[model samples]
Target: MTQTILYARVSTSEQDLSHQRTQAEKAGFVIDKVVADHGVSGVSTRLAERTEGKRLFDMLRRGDTLVVRWVDRLGRNYDDVTDTIRTFINRGVIIRTVINDMTFDGATKDPVQKAVRDALIAFMAATAQAQAEAVKEAQRAGIEANKGDVTKYRGKKPSYSRDQFQTVIDLLSNGAGASAIAKETGLTRQTILRIRDDQPAAETALVKWGM
Candidate 1:
């Protein structure tokens, strides 16, 4: 029997894997196994270099099917995503995305079909990369904007709730490094650092905004 495996990756712990799994299930995937990497930035780490991602590469058989919520979950760069999909396809694995039910199979010998398939893969990978960068840039911008205006900012609605923010503060109080706290809470390193360095200000803003 051909196995159906779901590979989910999130840069922060705040991101939920259940949502991705739900997306896959809604798209009619019967996942036999799930492999995930948490609190690992996709932009900085290649899927092949991740702990669970490495295991995914080793465990997937030739006839196995791989499912992902989107191409971005597989990688953050266009070349990396394209190359990773190609490598899996070359091994007779079917790669499918839940978002569009996009399928990539490298089983065709026809030159025209191969070209079309390759082009689509490249486009999708590039799109995914662009979206990831956009989100990061937006986050950076939001942080910068909030830095100058305490009363007007209120911390851009926060990525985590008050309780979650409190957890970050507690970790910092315990002398945890920003990176360590980020890994522990599934938050971005920037977020961890900001809360760590300015917990008092953040707490004030949270209370003021009732966040």
Candidate 2:
């Protein structure tokens, strides 16, 4: 029995996965598993730390079918997205999209059709990145609207625990770089970098909380 798997992600937990769910269901996918990365930015093309992204590897098999709202769901950028799709296709997995009903399959007799499919995948991956940028722009607008309002906290909790973050620092201090740390921990290099470069205040919180 071939199972169809649905993968989805939203940059913020506040953003609903319902839309992707609805689309996949409407497109006739049974959705054996829903792997999602909430509050994950699509601008990141690496399949590094996306909770669902990693799950996709374990859940997928040669015969299983993969469905997504779009290619962007797999990646935040074009090259990564294309590489991923091609790898899946090479592995004998079928990739399908709800929008445009785009399909990329490796089982084709004609060389021309294969070329066309490859080109389409490349184009769609770029489109996915463009749409992700749009999503981020919209989120920025919403954040700006509530700027300086301090009355409300409108964001999802961090997936990494404070202890885990400090552990990241400790590991770094112990001579671990981003790549090494990511391998040591389950987190992505980008996530570690984000903690290091963007969130210095988080370090104080870690110390104050005894993490």
Candidate 3:
């Protein structure tokens, strides 16, 4: 009745899937199944909107447990984050985060216990939102700082092949939208558009750097 299901997410396709997978594995979870959402920015609080997110609803069950590397993986918005966790609780699912070793459940019958549980959920959700906002603000500042000068190097390496780039182009040329390409190729829309714009330099960088 109690088992672990893994969830991993990345803001961009260039991020390596193996990294998250390793984290979950190292945390002592064999990962009976994995739900991965790619190219969905953490700044967005709607976990359900992520491509692989909906799959979680289908794969997880009442008695099963949900596992993530961190609480932020559940959501970025405070209300929605708390609601999502509590929803799973109502359905008899236990939510566990590897980073903090936290657990949330709906097994208590006492009112005070319920109040404590809800309070904890609210606090975790608010902290997740604050963390998300902080990351977003930092990214915006970095972009603004680099807006006038293309002098510094971005630590992230690009990832894509010429053939891969052409695939995106062809998909677009055939009238496929960004979302469609993302679903089909497991590449993010931002990645697809970059290829569509014919950035040969970017394409090469994608190959050389493996974004």
- In model 1, how large is the Cα lDDT of residue 29? 95
How many clashes would you count in candidate 1?
Answer: 1
| Segments in model 1 whose C-alpha atoms lie over 4 Å from true places | 148-211
Question: What ranges in model 3 sit over 4 Å off?
Answer: 1-3, 152-211
Residue 201 lDDT in candidate 2: 44
Q: For candidate 1, lDDT tens digit of each residue in 93-131?
A: 999877657789878999999999999999888887875
Each model's TM-score, in the order given?
A: 0.70, 0.62, 0.68
Question: How much is 96 displaced in model 3, in angstroms?
Answer: 0.5
- Give, for candidate 3, the lowest lDDT window spanning 10 residues: 201-210
By lDDT, the candidates rank as 1, 2, 3
Best by TM-score: 1
Cα lDDT of model 2 overall? 0.70
- lDDT by residue for model 3 (121-171), tens: 788778778756654565556557667554332435655543455446445
Give stretches of model 2 more than 4 Å off.
133-211
Counted clashes in each candidate structure = 1, 2, 6
Give the root-mean-square deviation of each candidate in angstroms: 12.2, 16.1, 13.4
